[model samples]
Target: MTSHSAPKLAWTYENRLLLILFMTFGFVFFDRLALSFLFPLMSAELHLTNAQLGMVSSALSLTWALSGAATGAWSDARGTRKPLLIAAVLGFSICSALSGLVAGFVSLIAFRALMGIAEGPVLPLSQSLMVESSTPSRRGMNMGLLQGSAAGLLGAMIGPPVVIGMATAYGWREAFYVSCIPGLLIAFCIWRWVREVPPGGVRHAQAEGAATQAAGGTTVSRWALLKERNILLCVLISCCFLTWFVVIISFAPVFLVENRHLSPSGMGVVMTCLGAAWVLWGFAVPAISDRIGRKPTMIAFALIAAVCPIVLIHGDSVWALGTLVFVTYTGLGCFTLFMATIPAETVRPRAIAGALGLIMGAGELMGGFVAPTVAGFAADKYGLQFAMWMSAVGAILACVLSFALVETAPAVLRRRALACAAARLDTQNVGGR
Candidate 1:
């Protein structure tokens, strides 16, 4: 894999970078979810209240949004990513480890916020890199694996068990201490293996930039990005989808145990279904989009997403509910399209990272910061089902909004172009005959 001729090097480089980025994002999520996974132990030990927990989560999200946007813009302007990415991995890992040392609520908030600051740029930076390196045909799938599958498997599915098991055996603090190890290893891998951008990617990006410039897009400031319809729709979609995601993740377990009167074991099983669905559709939806086009895939998956919250409310029998949830929980795949793939395809090559960061920041601010508070308030005032219904509303809005999106899938667009060319040629031949 390492030694190859130029033609083969592109392939090798693409795979190597994909594998590393996959692991990189996986560790990012692993570290990111550590707080929630260890919250019970930390809450008990620090005597923290529900209000403190919300504040703590919001603190991280606030910094995450700001840092993602700022860091992305910085990298795009400077024309660099590797060093920043390496620093981000190291920074977040250390911060996650520091979580074990927190004495009280304030310290926890400080470390989590620091962690978010470091972790924020990882998505846009990694995605921009992925977009550059990948072949046009595989872009959707590569980004899907990097963003969806990796996070779903490492963070959502396997993370809780490992964290809880370690906390149970040693202590939650000890679990945090050990969490830094994976990030350190992943950072080392990136430092050694990754390139700033591949030769093909650089050329491809140049070609893309030429096309954009010819289309009268000379520069891609954040404000300029907003002027593009696809970027605007993607940002709004991010907000709504984040609401769908955050509310479900935040309240699902408690809602099951308390509101639905499901036993603890039953609730755990239902949540497990969510983790499974997150992993399965994470890559599947985007890969399918590669063939069918991003618009149809997005609309169809979002329609599926709307049904998941309702299924949670009314679904009966552990086996039946898990199946229903898994089937309907198709939003993770759509996330890759809207959050990374759509933006990358729509914007000029230079501003890929900034566009991603802006959408992410806006989404996190609404879904991560504001939505939770509002959902929690509704839950307290009414009931947890109110939060579930709110999630459904978010998904439905995202579906409706997706109708306005222009087709961005390379394969689909290429097909249309070829068909148009054929039609033009046929008309010319008939006139000549």
Candidate 2:
């Protein structure tokens, strides 16, 4: 089996899929982060504590991790992308609308968990779809676009101000109700535009055959995938990355309001910097990896991220803190790299989605689920500043783990292959002479 590259097609199904999935994920982020922005209002009304708030946030992540682990494998076995995505979008949209009707802590947690179950599969499955649709050269950038740039910008940057304004005018509950409308529309669009591609389909059969030969003509077992060093490391590094991520998004607003003496509107303005930074780095860094290599790019980002908490803790002024937040989140753009691009490039195509699920699931379970709960507890017992250090430590550990990663960028792999072939050909010619 010979490996062949897909031609880069502009303004076709590929671009269209990217655009829709990009918007789909943007709505997903909007719905999820809306809860964070509204937490202060909800807490005041419901008499919730810091620990209870953390538990509410963790509830979604708990179900998300559990569902993602199963759904990734299920999608792989089912060999369809569109139906899963459609179901996920509709399920979460309805749940998001229903979130407004919750009466107390139990109901709020339960609804969020249900939303988690619906939304969990969207990340890995959409990533798998994007990879299949794109040319090899564009895989990293497309994944970034879907997971980071557009989604991050819409969800984090625009979502904060928009949701905050809506809450102020209507109510926090109504904001949740309003957020679901876009998701419902995106679900309909996906059902219409998105096509399913099976594993041995006409377009990808050659790529699959080549991958099989590369694996010594054997099918990959789930157990075998778990054993790969890169796969294991990706899961670990993602946990660290998510630790930094979940803590900030879940509690940063609270910290700003309570400890830093910033108003709700001011906090919204500062948090928008995070989204802006994410948009910039998310689009630029992964595309840069297409040329430089994944390992080096990740290492650089992780190192910068490790310092974010320290800078953020010391900055007293709003503009200074906002600038630091931007820098910190700029490093966070590598979320796509750890979660999808690296795992996909390392594994066979058939195993890509499942591998992504493992990476996402494990990270969410530890970093997303547990980290925030612990941070909230720490903030309650120790102080908010102490809680921020937890994220800094996680970022440092992520930087350490990144050093162990294997480079799997397509361009780098191809360059090495070409060099090897050239070396062998030169030896053969010299012997003949």
TM-score of each: 0.91, 0.91
Candidate 2: minimum summed lDDT over ten consecutive residues — where? Answer: 1-10
List, residue by residue over 33-136, the lDDT tens digit for candidate 1: 76765665576789975446556766777788999999998887667799999999999999999999999988998998999999999999999899888888
lDDT, candidate 2, 1-433, per-residue tens: 2223233332267789899999988888888888888988888888877877778778899999989878998777556677989999999999999999988889999999999999999998899888888878788988988898876788899999999999999999999888888988999999888877622335352467566678787445567887998898888998998888888778878888888898899888888888888788887889988999998888888878777767667888889988987877755568888899999888877788889888999999999899989988888999888767888888778888989999999789899999999999999999999
**Position 320, candidate 2: lDDT:** 92
Supply the TM-score for candidate 2: 0.91
- Stretches off by above 4 angstroms in model 1 are 1-4, 49-51, 199-219, 261-268, 425-433
- Which candidate should be chosen as best, given lDDT against the real structure? 1
Candidate 2: pairs in clash = none
How high is the lDDT of residue 181 in model 1? 95
Kindly report which residue stretches of model 2 are placed more than 4 angstroms away from their true locations once superposed: 1-11, 198-221, 418-433
Give the best candidate by TM-score.
Answer: 2
